[model samples]
Every structure is written in C-alpha cells, then in structure tokens.
Target chain A: MAKTVDAKHIISITVENKPGVLARISGLFSSRGFNIDSLAVGETEEPTLSRMTIVVKGDEATLEQIRKQLGKIIDVVKVQDFSGLDFVERDLALLKVNAPAAKRGEILQIVEVFRGKIVDVGQRHLMIELSGPEAKIEAMIALMQPYGIKEVARTGRIAMVRGVK
Target chain B: MSKKSKTSKPVERGREPKTGSQILVDALIAEGAQVIFGIPGGALIDVFDALYDAPLRFILTRHEQGAAHAADGYARATGRVGVCMATSGPGATNLVTGIATANFDSVPIVAITGQVPTNLIGNDAFQEADITGICRPITKHSFLVKDVKELARVIKEAFYIASTGRPGPVLVDLPRDVSRAVCEGNPSSEISLRGYKPVYEGNIKQIRLAAKVINDASRPVIYAGGGVIISGASEQLRALAKKAHIPATTTLMALGAFPEDHPLSLGMLGMHGTAYANHAVMESDLIIAIGARFDDRITGKVDAFAPHAKILHIDIDPASISKNIRVDVPVVGDAKNILENLIPLVEPAEHKEWLKTIAKWKKDRPLTYSDTGLKPQYIVEQICEATKGEAIIATEVGQNQMWAAQFFTFTRPRSIITSGGLGTMGYGFPACIGAQVGCPDKIVFDIAGDGSIQMNIQELATAVNNQLPVNVAILNNGYLGMVRQWQELFFKKRYSHTTLTGSPDFSKVAQAYGAEGRLIEKKEDVRPALEEAVASPRTFVLDFHIDPEENVFPMVPAGEALDKMIDGLA
Candidate 1:
C-alpha cells in the first residue's frame, strides 16, 4: 500500500552544471504538480556540479515520486531528502523597513534580538540583513511587519546534514 | 543479438577537419543507422547535401510528423534507435506529437532538427523555433549544439540517451552555422556520463521478498507492459508464469509480450480490456507487475484497483513505481535482469481453484461480436489469419486501434506498434512504412481509421517511392468512431461533427499515388482483399467499409472501477 505521510520536506539535489539544467529541474517540479514552498540553487564546491535545495509539501508517496522523478533526469547526479534526518537549514532575508526616527529604537532592539545587521540607513528606512532557519526568518519578518516593511528580498532555504560524513 | 552492439567503441579513422554536417553523417554511419526518415528544409540543406554522399538512405516524408512516427516504428520493430530530421519552426513543431507519442511508449528515437543560425536564434528569425525548449518535457533529454566541435559528441550522446535505460525519444537541435562550421571529426568513442547511470541489477532481497509473496498468495497475475518488449524479456516473462503457474495479463502496449493463445494468458487488462482479465485482476491476491507502470487507463479507479492484491512492480524507472498505485515490493532495475533473477527464486505451484475460477470467468464472458456486415474486428481477425499472426501490425488510434488490439493475436515481441500514451492519430501508415523498411522480410500492416488515415495519407507517395509494399487496411467507418461511441453512450448521440462526409475516396487516392487500391464492402471480400494486398509488389491500400456504430465492449467508463465494465449496453 502507498504510504501517507504529509509534511514539509527539504530535498537536496546534486546535478551537473549545464545550460538549461535549472529550467529542466523546475519544469519537472511544475509538470509533476509538486508544491515547492521554496527553492535555492547555486554552484557547489566543485565548479562542474551544482546543488539545489527545494522545500516542498507533499505526502510520503508524493515525495518519493518526486525523488524518483528527479533522479530520472539525466543531469541529476544525486538526490538527498532530509525528511527524517538531522539537518541544518538557512534562509537569508534583507528587509527594508520604514524606520522613522520615532520607531528607530524599537526596530533596532528587535533586530538585535534576531541578531540581524542594519546594513543601510536612510532618512525613512533601515535595511536589515538577517540569516537563519526559515522559521526564524519568518518570525523576524512578522515582528518587522508592524513597522511597515517597504521591500523584502529573501534567498530561499539551503540545507545540509548536521553532521559531516 | 546478431546486430552490432550499440555501445561498441568506434573504430579509428583518419582525422579530418570536416563541416558539422559531414561529422553528423559520419556519426550516424558509425552508429549503424541504416536509414533516416525526414524532409529537407532551408536550415537542413547543408546536412542534406552531406547525406547525398553518405551511405545512409534518407526517405523523404511529406510531413515531419510522418518522419517521426516512421522512425519510431522502425525503432520499435528492429530494436534499434530510429532517426528523423526536420527544420526549424513549423517543421520542428510538427514533430511534437510524434515525438511525444514515442516518448510515452518508450520507443528509442532521435529527432534531429536544424535551427536558425546561432546569431539569429533569439532574434525571431524566419522559420525559427526553440525546438529544444518545446521538446524538453517530452524528450528524455535534449541538446542545443551551439558549437560545431560538439556536434559529433552531442549526436553520440543523443543516441545513447535515447536507447538506454527506460528508452525514449531524444532531440538534437543543430544551428545552421554549427552545421556549416568546420571541425575535427573525431567523434567521442567512449560515453561516460557520471550523472546518467541506469541500474540494471535488482536488489536480491526485494526479489526474494517478491518470490515469497508469490509463493504465499493463493492467486497471482503477471501484469506485463511494453517494457517487457523493450527489454526483450518476453522469454523470461513466459518462463516465470509457466514456472509459477501464474496467469498473465498484458497491457495494450505489451500485446505480444506473452502469447495470447496460452491458457495462462488473460489478454489485456483494465479499460476496454477483456472482462475475464479485469475480473482476474480484481480477484487476484497478488499482482506481479513487470515493466509496467500502473497508468490510469489500467487502474480505472486508482483507490479501488486491485484492492485485494499486493502489487510487486518491477520496472527500470523507479518513478513509475507507486506513482499512481502503491507497490508492495518495488524492484528498480531492468525488467529482464529482475525476471531472470526472480524466475528461479519463485516456487512453482498451480492454484487449481483460482485457475478454475478464471477459466469460468473467461467462458462466461468471452470477447463476442456479431458475424454480420463488414465488421472491423472480423477484418483484423482475417489479417491475423492471413499473416499467421506474424505481421508487424501498426495501428492508428481510436476504434480501429482498439479493434486491432482485440481481434488480432500477437505471438511475439515488437509485433504490434500503436500510439498508446499520446494516442496520436495518423501514426499507423508511416509506422508501417518504417517497420517494413526495418524488417523487409516480414509483412507489415497498418490498421487505420478513415478519420486518421487522411492525416498522413500523403505518405502513400513515400511508400510507393521506396517500394516498401506496406499494406494499409483502412477500417472506413466514415466518422471519428471512438468519439462517436462516447457520444452515443453519454452525449445523447449528438454526433458532434464526427462524420467524415467529404472525405476522399481512399481507393482512388491510393491509385492517384501510384499504388494498388481496393474498396471491400462485403465480408467475403475481406479475406481476398487482404490476400491481394499482401501479395502486391508495391504499397497497397485496402478500404474496408465497416460498421459505423460498433463500439468497443467491456469498457470501464471514465472514473469507474475496472470490474464495473459496461459490456455493450448489457
């Protein structure tokens, strides 16, 4: 019988760095109807290879299907699903908040609590840079919402096993 | 295995700086291509010029779609990678349906499409289309060769990717400049792709587990698919069934994987399948699915399909397992290798009671049709008798395809070729041409429909030009019969423009193309017409006027369970 385990999943994929690789991978996700909450891709330590971290929501069957489907792509070298593993994930976000001098102290304190850096300061805004797990990043975004955040840019989740092999 | 090994290392040749077109021809010759199906266009003029001096015979098809299907047919018939070519824009786009058809059925074919020059690629030049992008999702892999230096290697890689693993169509997009540029034609002899290794050996533990399940089950059925034929595992599949005393049911794609004449055979299963086969699957306790994906057409209602059975899916593509139906024992590897390993481990035992139940079901509701008028089924049966079930039968989709699948008995692998997944019309005639070209000694027949035959009717010229002697049996119902069947059953018989009132006389059309033609309206004429067509030296088209309203029986309506078949209005 098909297994039914629905939850968030982080899939780490290693693929050869080639033209249209990203398009092919993303096309596969869209074509298969898999829900991708977040996705991050970049060159790995080896220039010839690239790694992708995709955060998706699906049942065990869906995840397994996704993994198998991903593995079928000719350029995909390896697929690692961190579903039940000790893993560390990080998401970096840069938010430009409406920092009128009146609420400057409050925003700075909240940024300090999240260990975020104020990279830029203008007359009306403070650009804050924060990097952490997705939850932490989301929490910070929520705390800064009341301060009228102007623009936000986020690098989607990137993950690795907690321990070295 | 008398054919030269596809993976054999290339022979050393004197190094020569040649144009990319010359390299492409050399690569095809080295890859052991006997023929190419294609049309020439402005973008591919250089390649055509190079092919002029090459040994490969290029069969110029009227349409790019025909070229692709012909190549697919050749591949399916000969167990070799079929090749086709097209130009940019409309020509490349035309091959989409055929390429998708081959892809869905896992037929190994390589489509070479010439593109506008590299500088004009993104500039919206005339007759320019992003073919690689268009075929990306359908093809196993696609390459856009930007440089002449990579042409030979890309061609080699395209062929390798197409024929390996779960074989499917591959596309190579060559820019006009790339084909014209000079390069050292030292094609890569060794193909080493770190990311593209396909596992051939199944896990022994899983095989043993599957064996134990088979041994423990009171009833087991072997569900075979096209992969068995693709992997040439019919012998192994037959042995396993015989040794284990298990009943075998094939999918439409795997019509010839197991001989239908065998007592253990249940014919095809699932939608429009044999009633006995569906009943057996629903009642079986174990299903040994080999080289078959549980497609929705087979599953009917996925949740309730084979509810009482534990499925053991053995396929080369791991994704195919549990993608639709959950598999209990999933073995990922080549089906042939897994079956070879599994045959010995499985214990032999005949469930006398179970077999008796299946036999009763078969007797109770065997495939039945009226012996009146010029029935398409009777024509198919006659064709089978005439060829002794040995003809390479290719079919166009719809009622004609279903009729051929039901009535004709296939006794060997690669004997039946049809568009199963994409369900493309106009596939049969060109496919027959390819099959006849690939296997000249064997008779090839295309069972086509009136609506579908016209789609690629122009290919009669190609067939006559090549003197293929391919036979076409047009089940001329004068309508899109399959759709009309659905309309009759569900849509209040509105017809919905399904009639083909203005269609040309196929016989005269065939004669116009310099081939023999006959119109048979009587049952007595069917056998004689078939005999005459088969004996003809040139290509022959036989238009058999069949019943327009005949519907395929034992059909599981959309979203219904397999067992809940509507067996022809009660």
Candidate 2:
C-alpha cells in the first residue's frame, strides 16, 4: 500500500547572502538524494538575504524530510512549502529558433498568440523571450520545436504566495 | 591642536589596534577556548607567532590529522568546542578525514586552516589549497575570510556554529594576508546571527502527547543516542526510565548515556548490539527515541524495523527526525530541556510483563564469546574491571571497537568515546590524548587494533612529550580482524590483503618514544599488564596478542532485521 510515484513539491527557502551558501544547500539536497526539478535564486527585499525557490519531485514523506533537512542548514533562515498553498509560479525562457524568411512570418504569428517578444535577430535564427508559468513556457517550447529550435535557456521556476493581505 | 590631540588620544585609549592574527587569538580566548591542537607550517607562522604570547595552550601534534582528531576527542570528552589549526595545502588536506569523522559523529570542533594570500589564492602559489571548498561538505559551516576586519567575527561565528544545534566541525580558512593585515578593532564578545538559532524548548503539547502514548502502551522501550550526552540529559533520561519502569537501550555513540549496570539497561541496540535490546525494540509497542538518529546501523531493514511501534523521536536537530525511519511524534529541542519537561508530564507506569520478557531474552542469549585462546573481549572485560568502569575509553574502528562497545560497562556520560558514524580507524590514540588533556584527573585508554594502531602511531611521541598518561591497549591479532572476519563469513575466507603479519612490535615502538611498553602473550599476564599500565605515571602501551580468528557476535548482517542477529560462532 506504499506510494510508488513521487509528487511535485515547491519549497521556498530564505538564506543569508554568504558565499558558498548556495553550494551548501545544493550539496545537502544532492547528498540526500533529493531531486531538484527546478531551482531559482535571487536577492529578497533585504539585500543581505537571498530567497531560493526549488521545485522538487518526491513523495509527501520525502518533501517533509527535505523541509526538515533544509531547516537544519545554519545559513537558511526559513523554509516554506508552497506546493499545497495558493502560489503564483513563473519561469522565464529564451529560445533561439531557426527563423528563415519563410518561417519568420509564421513564428511571429505564433509568438503573438503566446504573448512572446523577439529579443534578438540573427542571420539564421531569431531569439524569442517568454515569461509565464512553467506550463506556458513548455507550450511555447513545444510549438517552436517543429520550427527547428537552435537553442534554449531557462531561468528555472520562481514562486510566491498569491493573495491580498 | 589640543582638541585634535585629545580626540586621537581617546581613540587610541578606547581600542587598541592589533594584527588579525592577534585578534584571532583574542577572539578564541574570549570564546573561552582553553587549549588548541595543531601543527605549525609556513602559512600559519604569523598566527603561531601571535599564539606564542596568547594565554591558550596549544598541543603540537605530529600531523594535522592527529590534531583534528585530538580536537574532536577533546570536544567529545569535555563538551567544549574543541579548536584545531593547520597550515595550507597538504596540512589542510590532511585534516579532511578527521573533519569528516567529527562531522559524522556530531562533535563540536572548530578547525582553522591557513590559506594562500588573497591575491595569490587562485594563482596556485606554493602550499595553497582550497580548504574552504574541500571542507564545505564535511563541516557544519566554513568561512574564507577575505577581509581582516571580519577575522574576529568569523572566529566567533565558527565557534557558535560548531557548538550549537547538533554540534559538528566548522572550518575557518584564514588567508596569510588577512592574518598579517593590521585591523583596528577589539574582538566582540557578543554574537547575534539572524540565521542561526537552535531550538532548546520542546512543545508542551507534543510532550504531553508523548507521555499519553508512553502511559497507554503495554510494551515500551527507550532508545537513546549521543545527543543525550551532548545535551547533558543523562540524569533526566535515567530518571524518566526509572520512573516509567521502562527498559532502555543506548546506541554505540551513547554507550555511557545510561549506566550499563542499571537493571533497566538493555545495553546497546542495533547491528552489533545486545540481542535482548534488539528483541525489545522489535517487540515494543511504544518506542521513545531520545536524541538518537535511526541510523542504518541501528535500524536494519527499515521497513521491518519496529513495525509494531509508534516512535516518539526527540532531538535538537529537526533534520534528524523522521529522516531515516518515520516517527509518529517528533519533539525538536534540547534533550535535557525536553526531558526535564517530559519527565514531569509522564505519569509513573509499570510494565512488569514487558520487563520480564526482556529479562528472559537477556538471560537466554547473553553477550558471550568462546574462549579458545586470549580473546579480545576477555581483555576488554578485564580492562573494564581494572578501571572499575571509571576510565574514559576511546576506540578505533573494527573488531576492537565492537568488542569494547560490547564488553566494557560504561557507567558515566562521556566515558566511552568512539568514531561511531564515520568508523574511522586511527581515531582512538590521538583522541585519547585529547581526552586525557580535557580530563586531566581521569584515566584514559585507547582500545585499538593492531592495524588501526599503526595508522596514527606517530602520536606516541606527542603523548610522551606532553607527558599525558594515556594507556593504549593494542588488541594484536596479526590481521585486520574485522575485515578478515567479514571476508571469512561473506567472501568465503579469501583473506586478501587483510593480514598484517609483519607489523612492527608495538612494545618496542612504545619504548622508542620514551614510554613504557609491555607485550602480554599469556592470558595470566593480562591483568598484571593492565594494572601496571594503569598504575604507571607515564604513557604506556600494552600489546595483547588476542585470538586471530575471533569475531564480534550478535551481528545483524547488512539489510537483515535486528531480531535476525547471528548470535555466536558455530
């Protein structure tokens, strides 16, 4: 009767802005065999503190274990699990697609429908930047996959609680 | 001009400018550091120079590894944040194993390593290694101080982090330039870190709930670990166990947390644990785990471990709760404080039937080994008798460790120190040196195997020079006893590379270092040798030639259930 499949979990951690703090956090995760699906880190309102939003794939017990382990890190100030809460998640991705003269018009049309922007243009390709939920980014990437995608770079998911205080 | 002179004079009077090295020394002293273990090298000359005038005493170890282990031992024995220092490159790298040992065992140790100059750090200068990076995984926290102004603060923070919240080793890498740089500030005695806070009080609700469970259960057992000693909760734990009339078992790291002579004591539980303790755990309805992590060695076949029990885990580190084995009630706090709160709430209860069952199991398969020749267990039992369960015993890993843990009856906290989690060989001798230094009035013994004794044999010189009357009892079996036993049982007696046939005569080696040495080959000489070593005022080494084929019993093979322990030799 044990659960066989892992569920997705989003955990946010606030930590001090010290060198190698990120490495310490990631090292703990890897050593404990917790798979980090998506990770995004940035400075919070306080310049000395950084917030890390990590999406991990694990069972409920695994997530709880991860939360406890994360809290044990001395540099980590707080750990909050937002997977079961109302949270707004976003991911930013840039795609370099093979946009020949023929496909340029079609790519632009698709970009318009997806609310994307053309950030850079090259001789053989056009770079498109998109920011939205992980699903929307994945949809955009899937649509551009047929157009011979040249390259892709993504700033993994970041999340915050969505509510009016 | 008079006003300017007055302002400058006030500034000079208020705070004296000192070099970073001097400030570091002052900071350590302010943090109440009494002794440090280390060896000086080129990069740390300035710091050593400053230490020359400092009030703290430094034990010059033969190697940096010895220094690190000694510091770990000092911390384990005294409950103080032990300090160690080493120079850059090889000196720093040599501390890696010892740091990992301390980290795994949760010993509070602050390891300070010298680094190359800040400008020359990445330039691959002579005797430079990225120690901060190297020790990051092994240490609780690490610092590479780029600015001399932060030297004192970093040292203070290192001590704080090392000693608090499941204490472990912390490394502070001081660059040569930073150590030599002049800084204009006095060391701060106050520490206020926003991120680092350890929970010391257990939730009353959880404690009450745990008490209710303990009261309701027909069969209950208490499992204690090293945290009981670290938090100084031995008395509280004993009081709780005695009040509840529940049998208690301690892990290897917690050997002395509960007195073995106590009637309620089930001794140690787990792989090499007592048969009765393991059986009690397997059959218990309520398991109270205090400051103990359910490590793999303790909980074999996690799914089958204590299947009928509702575990109540109490520990200071929240991470250790339900990390390996899931628990029903988790209390995160200092063991002493939590037990103090819990003992009052837990009503007196009796499990006469449960105790009877455990007692029957204990009487049925007691810890025993067949005596064909001079057995290591026999020697350990004799040592225990000689010390009257008072000497602090430190042990290296392998068969000797298991035998000591099994045979030696520990009656006080911090009396038995071993590398439990890391299982590092060569840990005992140097650690005994630290233990002797930490507790100058107590007799300290290092129960070592021949193979393990040779790992840090050079420390005999340090022990002799320091005049630390550390008695080392080498269980000489002419083979790496534990590995050979494993090979014999699991590898069809392959015996590949396990023989240490031509090992140096330990007695002669001890004499060469200006210490007393005795080689006891006969069984009758065991007590006399031990007595002589104990009575001697100087360092001594007794090589007890034990049975070569003897093996530690009551071992639960890896991945097997605790109750499925293989009892004694066929």
Candidate 3:
C-alpha cells in the first residue's frame, strides 16, 4: 500500500500566462522540498493562459499537499493530477545516435519498428524524432545505447483525458 | 494655461490625471486603510510627497523592519489589512525578517516597496533590488508594477490577496518612474482574479463525518490555533466544546481564541504547555484540530504524538491538512464556517471519565514557579493581574514569551500577540506600538527579554515620536535566558556566548528616547512599576531584574514525546 501510494505522479496545472508565473510555481515546489522529475510548460489554446505538466515522485500525502499548495498560488488557475484516470500521454524525444556506416541500416530498421522518423542525418550521427509514452521513449533509448547514442532531448510528459468535454 | 489650452490633457469628470503615487494613495484610502507604518527613501520620495497631503496617517518607524512588524501587529490585533512601505534594496531587505515573521504566522499585511526607475531596474542602479523576487517565497503573493496604468489594479489585487483566505503578507514593488508617471485611468475599486477565489464553505459530507467522529468519541480534545482568531471562530469553537463537553487546548497562537479560565479549557498544549493538556492529547481517542496545524512544537515526536488519537483537522488551507499529521477526516474551509455547520450536527455528550482524568492531572501538576525571588513568571503574572487579562500583550521570542503565555489567562481573541511560528526576537515593541495604535482604548504591553528587546530596541524612538503610550516590561536576566536554560539542561552548562554581563540600563535607554522608565530589582516593585507604566501618557519601559538561572517549566526537550516533559512537578 505504501509503495503504491509512493510512486511517480503526473500533475497538470493551468495558469494565467503572466510574468513570473513559472517562477512562482517552481519556487513553491523548492520551498516545500518537492523534487520535480520533469516539467514542461507552454501557452495553451487560449492565448491568455498557459498549461504546465509536472512529473514528480512522492507519497499520496505529499502529492495531495503539492496539489493543494499549487492550487493556493494566485497565478495557478487549476490543478489536475492524472492518477487512476483514462488519459492519452505523449512525450517527444530527439535522439542523436552515433550511426556508423556499418550500423546505419540496423538503426533505421529499429527506428521503423518504433514508428520514429529520422529528421537530421549527420556524417556520423542520426537525429531521430520519436513521439510516444515515456516508457517507450526509454525503451528506444535503451535499444539505441548499443549503437552509440550521442545525446538526447526529451519533452516531459503531456496528457489529455480521453473523451473529455 | 490661462485659456485652458487644447494641447493639455483632457480632464475626466473635472479631475486631472493623477500620478502613480497619488493613485497608490487613493487606492489605499479606497481600501479603507487608516494608517501606514513606513520609512521614506530616495526611491519613495514621490510617494512620501503624495502622502504629505493624503488623508491617511503615516507612521515614521525607526527602521523598515519596525514598520513591517508594526503593520503585522496592527493586523493581528485589529483583523484589518496592515500596510507598510519602504524603499528599494537595503530598505526592502530590512523588512525581510518581519515579513517572514508575519508570513509564518499568517498575518494579513501589504508591504509596498519602492524600486529604481523602470529603465534602471536590472542595471543594479542605486538602492535597486529585486524586491518582488526577494519576497516571492515569504509573501502570499507579490507584484512588480512596471506600468503606471496597472498601479490601481495591482494595489487592489495586493490587498485582496493579503487579506483573503489564510491571510498573509503581500508585496508590491513600484518603480520610481512608475510612481512619477501619470495614471489617466480611475483608481480601480473592483478586484477579479480568476485563480484567487478562496473556498469558504466546507463540504457537507466531510463536516458530517467529522461531527459523527466527535459524537462517537469517548475521549475527545479540541485543539485550536491562530485560525480560530483569524476566522473569528472562537464563539463557534466555545459553543461546540460546551455542547460536546469536550476539553479544549490551544496553541500559543490560539492563546486568546478560547478563554483559559473556562472549565473545559486545557490552557495550552505542547512544549512548555500544561501537563494535563499534553496528557489529554496523548490519551485522546479523537483530536478535533481546528485552524491549527500540528506544529512540531505541539507534536514533539511525529510518530509518538497523540498515539491513540484519530485526528479530524479543519482549516482554510488545503495544504495544511494532513501535511504534518495523517488526519482521518479533513474539512478544508474557513474555521468559523465549518464550525457553524459542524456545531449543529454534533450531538451532546458528558465524557465524565475523560473530564475527571484531565481535572486530576491539572490539579496534580498545575503551572508553578518558586515565588521566593524576582522570577520572570512572577512578573508576567503581576502584569496579567494588573491588566485583568484584558491588555493586548505582545512578546518577543524566548523565555519571556513562554512565561507570558503560561501566566496570562487570555480570554479574548487577538488579545495575545507573539511571534509564534518565526520566533523572531525584537518583534514585540513595534508590534505593541501597532497594536496600541489599532486599539487605542485598550492598554498594550510588550513583554520582552533583555536579549530580545535589544534586537529592535531602537523602535522606542518610533513609539516616543508617535506618543503611543505603550508599555514595555523587560525581563532582564543578564543573558539569553532560553539558550542558557538549554545549556544548563542539555549542554552541561557550557554557557558559550549567551551572557550579557555589561548590558545597558533599559530604563536609561527608555529615558534617552524621551519616554519614562523605571528599574525594579525586587519583586515588590514589579506591580507598582507596571501600574506606573500603564498609567503613564508616554511610552514607558519597566526593567525588572529577574533570576538569571530560571527556565521555562514543562519543557519537552526537542524531539522528545509530548508527555516527556522536564519540570519539578513532572
């Protein structure tokens, strides 16, 4: 029960797109001793507001507190934790793999298997773009490790409830 | 000018365009502000100039910190939004401790800080500081007003944020250029923040669950804190306790929220709290905690605190619920509102056995001190007796604060003002001045330690200049008594740097500030000095030389269980 309660949790927050809003949210987390696993924020469909997705690992109690504390900030409009909810989650990752001429075909085959796209090809590296769940991204990264991965940039998790209004 | 030139700006309703500073002043007046405790600097010269003819009374505090604390004290005493003003950089930095002090205790205050001109903001111009950023963590909310047109709306938002749910300090940093610029728009009176609405009503289902728990419990205790006073829920709390026949214990912040003289009153609970209160909490089957977070001071060892209790916590801040203690039932809303709803659902019960047990414990280990010499506790009792428990008492942190809390039977909400959460020294005098200003008809006293008093002792000049007639009772023990006590008990009496053998005469210091002073080395002179100081029309300091080796009784050493207290009776 404790282990289940204490696990990776993803929280989505909608806030007014004003100056210092990010600073306020980030500052609250730091002051409360909450460590963020990943954070992604951008302007929403409404130009006046921004949506933030924060992935953090904490117990149920701590998560509740984080949700409540986040709700307390004046700039934060709404907080929703996608726990035990039917949602479609996606994260984008760009991986620069060391694609040797001898192994280029093998990397391409692996990319095709994962439904990924080869966006940029350098003399010795291939920048592959993949959009999937975090676990799938991690699995791809694991498979690319033997092929000598150079660097990776990942956009943190973003999710939408299925069949929402 | 003679012909009303067409090139001039158009008048709005026969009124000329107001400067940003004038708009700020007008906004404050519109918000119903009566006084502003502040200091003027170069960046704030325009605001000060505007304030010169403004209807609001400006208090010139000796330091920015004093101004902040005075504002906090005024807010705590009167339940109104207290306002303080200071310049940029160092002036704003000086208000940090006082701001944090108010923030920790959830006092409603608006701190207005002057900034360098907009163009010079990030250039590290003279007296420039990122005050909004500096105060971000300490304040409930903060704003840096760059445009003069937004000044009125920002001020409205700042006040609204500061005085609303779970009230706390808010900061507004105004650039010098903004202050000087013309604001053509009318000062905004309405505030609409999409993200700032507070939940005032508790969920009916949760309230019913809490009331059911209260009705079923055989040994229940009501633990109340500052929220009771802030929400004006003391009457509701008292009614519930009487109806349920459950004993009640208050935190230091909740001292005056529940009358200590009431039969079911457990006085105070936690470190240096009443023996019966601690015992009752530890043995309670149900703990209906209202407006009070289970601070470490109250729950000594997290796992060992109230080991047998099923906790029901009520508060306005949702984060505060179950943050420290795992609450069984949580009702997140205003205390008064929640209590009003819960009171009707609660059924009456006697709990004769529980009350008898608490009564026996109270009788067995009542708060006591050796009445032989000039004890600080004795001095506190004398002051309480002199005031008939009606004076608004402010206290600096340490032994004196604990003694005051222990001795005084606080019967009214907002009557006892002390730095509970932050425990900041040098907070009392300025707070006392603010309290006196807020409640002019009532007597206000600052019970202070010799060490803590000196931290912000310069506030005497502010009090004297304003003719506040506030009294200060200095419990002079020639050392940092609380630290010395810890050393005596825990550190084998190393005594380190706690001693102040050559401290200046406080009475003489008071006299230097053009206020009356009296030195009392004997217990016989304690009451007389208090009377004289209370009667004096000017600010007065009563320096009472007390026992150097005295320690606060019923102390649960840090990290020890609540019941593991150290005292002669224990």
Which of the numbered candidates is closest to the native, going by highest lDDT?
A: 3
Worst 10 residues of 2 chain A by lDDT: A1-10
Model 1 spans > 4 angstroms off: A1-5, B1-13, B184-189
Superposition error at B201 for model 3 (Å): 1.2
lDDT of 1: 0.92
Task: Please compute DockQ, using alpha carbons, for every candidate against the native two-chain complex.
Answer: 0.77, 0.61, 0.65
- With candidate 3 superimposed using the best TM-score fit, by how many Å does residue B528's alpha carbon deviate from the native? 1.2
Task: Report fnat, model 1.
Answer: 0.79
* Alpha-carbon deviation at B285 in model 3, angstroms: 1.3
Please give, for residues A1-165, the per-residue lDDT of candidate 1 as tens digits.
Answer: 546777999999999999999989999998888889999999999999999999999988888889989998999999999978998899999999999999999999999999999999999999999999888999999998999989999997999998779
B1-570 per-residue lDDT for model 2 (tens digits): 556546554555546678889888989998999999999998889999999988999999999999999999999999999999999999999999999999998999999999999999889999999898888778888889999888888888899889888899999999999999987544454665787889999999999998889888889999999999999999999999999898999999999899999999999999999999999999999999999999999999899999899999999988888778878999999999999988888889888999999989989989999876799999999999999889999999999999999999998999988999999999999999999999999999999999999999999999999999999999999999989988988899999999998898899999999999999998889999999999999999999998888889989999999999996754
* Highest-scoring model, DockQ: 1
TM-score against truth, every candidate: 0.97, 0.97, 0.97
For model 2, the stretches where C-alpha displacement exceeds 4 angstroms are A1-4, A122-124, B1-9, B12-14, B185-189
Clashing residue pairs in candidate 3 are none
In candidate 3, what are the lDDT values of residues B337-427, reduced to their tens digit?
9999999999989999999999999999999988878999889988999988899999999999999999998999999889999999999
